[model samples]
Target chain A: MQQEQSIAFKTGMLSICLFILLGLLYLPPESVAQQESSVPPGTAIPDSIQLKPPIHIEVKDTPDDAGGSVTIRWEEQPVLENAVIQKYRILRASVENSVPGEFIFVGEATNRATVFSDGSTDDDSTYVYKVEAVYELKVDDTTVVTTTVQSSVSDEVSSSAQWFNFQRINVFVGVVLLSFFILYYIYQAQSGKKLFIRKIAGLEAVDEAVGRATEMGKKIFYIPGTQDMDNVQTIAGVTILGRVAEIAAQYDTWLEVPVSRSLVLVTAKEIVKEAYSKVGRPDAFREDQVHYLTDDQFGYAAGIDGMVVRERPATIFYMGAFYAESLILAETGNSIGAIQISGTAMPSQLPFFVAACDYTLIGEELFAASAYLSREPKLLGSLKGQDVGKALILISLLVGTILETFHIWQFSSLFKVIGE
Target chain B: MRREIPLLITAITGIVFVLQYFIPHAPFNKMNTWFSDWFSIVGAFAIWLGALNLLKISFQKIMDKKSDWFFALVIIISFFVITIIGFAEGQGFREPGTTFSWLYDYVYSPLSATMFAILAFFVASASYRAFRARNFEATLLLLSAFFVMLGRVPVGDIITGFLPQQYQLSQVASWIMTFPQTAGQRAIMIGIALGLVSTSLRIILGIERSHLGGGD
Candidate 1:
């Protein structure tokens, strides 16, 4: 009897021990140490328990921008004991497409982020948003609990296109100020005022460059660049071309302009014809003088190269928007002992032109060349006005630097243009 | 009337463009698109004019037996062959595996690449002249170019391995690029921007009319 009783107790104890082991293996982890395994700080636990949602959900249209965006802001709930806030999940629904109270997941942000810019909104549709807060609770020494709570849905809000982007007020003011200066100077010029312009070496060399070609009795090659007529650089180039054409016509020198774009060819021919007429040599301007080449970039370069080699012009003028071909053209001109004058706004190609050409007009100097060559009072006044605008910009830069360094003010922020 | 009409149009168009920059409203928002569409239409017609001009010039050269008339003949033949192929292949001419695509890939692309490849030789020859160190400015340019070139290569690290990390030649090259080079580029950019603004203003106000074949 004693042996049978002992065996019964042993079996019962073994069954109970096996049951406890299975329970431990299958149940959700309760030990805080085990649950905290390798979880770095600030990572949200997906399992949520009940908590107070963020309060005062606010929705507003994004200001000073094109439509199609709404901004969401919320105030966090008052802190409670044992509830550590995690991240907030944002839910949004289009009023046009969904049943009431049903929403699709839009985005999420950390608890610290109070504002969210929702950019995927349609300009015409109204939207409602919900802000849900997630939190963690340590109920006991061995257990960590997660909870989530949602706030009331925001009222329907829609984004509308703004008529004026006020954020760019600073840029508008700058442009207006420049216009005022230019107009005032132009009026001064129209009334009888002598405007002094600092002499530009490139413009000074022009008359000499043309004179050399005339003396040598060689054809003058004028390449108005590879760009079409629409580029501002090309316009500057062709304007300078007018002055060059007049000089060429006066000298009775042969001038050739092999253009890459058809429109540029037409424009150049018109300018040359008018220039010739102005010089009392209308018969001298041939339609074929300004001709078209292939529109391909490198092909245009190759054609110019071939012409330069064959014709061996004494002077070559490269003015406009040139790319890699700038070096090719300049180097070819260099090899033939031709005087090369190049002007372009392209910063990358400026180095090449400076390296290879006899005279180079850098950046703003290209624009100034027209006025410098023509010596028109109105144009000269405009150049002088540009100097004034540049002066103002210099003042702003100095002021901004000093103010920022001293931490007295953020003067640079005034120049920040926010909207396009 | 001829000059006045064009100038008026230019002024109106310029004003509308400035308005569009400040306002995103209906007609202003679509003005640029409408104008660009018109330009493309004109450009398409101009392409034919260009082709005809090329043909006329080439034929004239071939008939007159100008120097290198054979090249003109080749240009004419190649132009027609490619035009015929492009038309015959229809809309799918640009698709892969088509004869037109094959021609573009094998002939046109290689020719373009060859032309671009010639630029490297030109750059080398030009750099030889520019980096001559003839004066103070040239010597500065030469030094900067040498350091920039050295730092871009693996050998730069090996050469400066004994120096402190910040004092390495590669780091020096990076500092030059990040500071002095960028400053110069930005200065030029600012000048260009001011010039562009000033020039555009002149054009809009009709103070600059040389582009329209009128004297200032």
Candidate 2:
């Protein structure tokens, strides 16, 4: 009887262990099976796509206008003896502190050429580029839908193009005007010449918004945008944040800032602290008021939605780079009837902001906003210089178009030579 | 001196950028290229500065025993791990025939997809919240949003009975995205571009100085 009982007990334990082992092992496979069942065939990443070794790249002067643009060219992979090359993908990455892995898809073209023109007129910057060739494969002999297989990605092609050498006449004209302003401004600045800038209505309401929050004893919600610090718009957002924090400190209003990017979060903390210190309310600065949310876009948006719904801040300020989530956030804040002031350079999100927010800064206006609110002479002077530059561009455009219409090909050629 | 330096740099870079647009010659052409290279270098340095700043603040938060210290700790740990894996692994996931590459392929790639998959729920919830007909404009907005959403999913075809026939719901969706939607987007883009130009001009000319914290 004892021997029989022991055998049964041993068998039960063995079955339990087997169940646990199978449970753990079965989970991942089950999950994967569920995913496969739901996902349509051919939607997932194929087995063939890859990054080849980095390759030597060459940069040459671009044709047309002043040489602000560079044409980068690299050798294509020798076509396999049997396989047909279908397309080339050009990827670009900036050189500084940038993870080389963050290659941006710049251009894609059929196997006709291996050269690409980098005509980004912003300024001189060094960028590393990579190229990959996709090869054609006949998945089935019966149908025309040939599944294209990407070979091991071609080597990353690197090239450096400098825009310092290209100075054109239109640029010269713009330079002359700018030089005149700078010289004029330097003398004026030395003499302490006072300049007047127009008042920014959006900024004017900031103090009132904070005061209202203070009166109601409600927290203030501030979003410094969803972009990393590498973006210029984020820089502007942080600077404006300095002013907001100062008002919050003076009014003793609860100020909460949730940031999507770690870098931007850090900047906001510094700016907010500085503002608090400047307001002589350093003790009131709470570090937790500015916190880093997840870097995931929708995750951050989800967090913001929760915060807005739960806390119900009386005033919300959104400043910086925004994308699709802008509408979701603005609409939520609107539902809460929060007074919203938003500033961003994202053209796509501006309409949503305009529709939802009480005040919206459009495009470059966001960049100029802090200055507009400050009315400082130097800032005002720079804005004037920018205006002069634009006017010069506009005048040049008019003259060039008129000359082209009149068959004065030489004048037309002047502007036609960019990004060749 | 504080304001003068920025003004000079802005004026110089701004003018050169304009000139290069019209004159395509040797020295001037080359100068533009050099300028672009310099800008790239500056941009690179700026990125480094930002990264350093991020490390400094997170480290500070951890040191101070702040209320959200745990979150800060997670951030620092994740940042360092990612950085080390990225640099130490060299080309990281892009490196073929490596463990890191497989990790990226199976782990990071799927994680990204899963995160995007989560968006499906949030989008549905957000649509539910936004679709109420509060006013005429709101009604119009709800209508457009519904069509846009339906036009994207396979269920739209099932409801409309269009895809099996030549009038594929996907093609109709593409047309909606490309034409009327595109027109609206483009109009907004044009306004934004003009606004940007004018605003940049105002800043360069120093007519807008509120950002410097003295306009008050």
- Among all windows of ten consecutive residues in candidate 1 chain B, which has the lowest summed lDDT? B20-29
Model 2 ranges off by over 4 Å? A1-209, A216-221, A227-232, A235-239, A254-315, A324-340, A350-420, B26-67, B84-111, B146-180, B209-216
Clash tally, candidates in order:
4, 73
The residue-level lDDT of candidate 2 at A366 comes to 72
TM-score of each: 0.86, 0.53
Expressed as tens digits, the lDDT of each residue in A1-420 for candidate 1 is: 999999999999999999988876765422322344433456444344346678788999987666778999999567667678788878888899887666776788887889888888988899999887766776656557665667888988998778887887888899999888988887888798988888888889988999999999999999999998778899999999999999999999999999999888778888999999999999999877888889999999988998899889999999999999999999999999999999999999999999999999999999988888988888888888888999998898889888889996667888887753
Q: Which parts of model 1 are misplaced by more than 4 Å?
A: A1-54, A75-90, A93-98, A104-114, A118-126, A132-149
DockQ for model 2? 0.09
**Span of ten consecutive residues with least summed lDDT in model 2 chain A:** A143-152
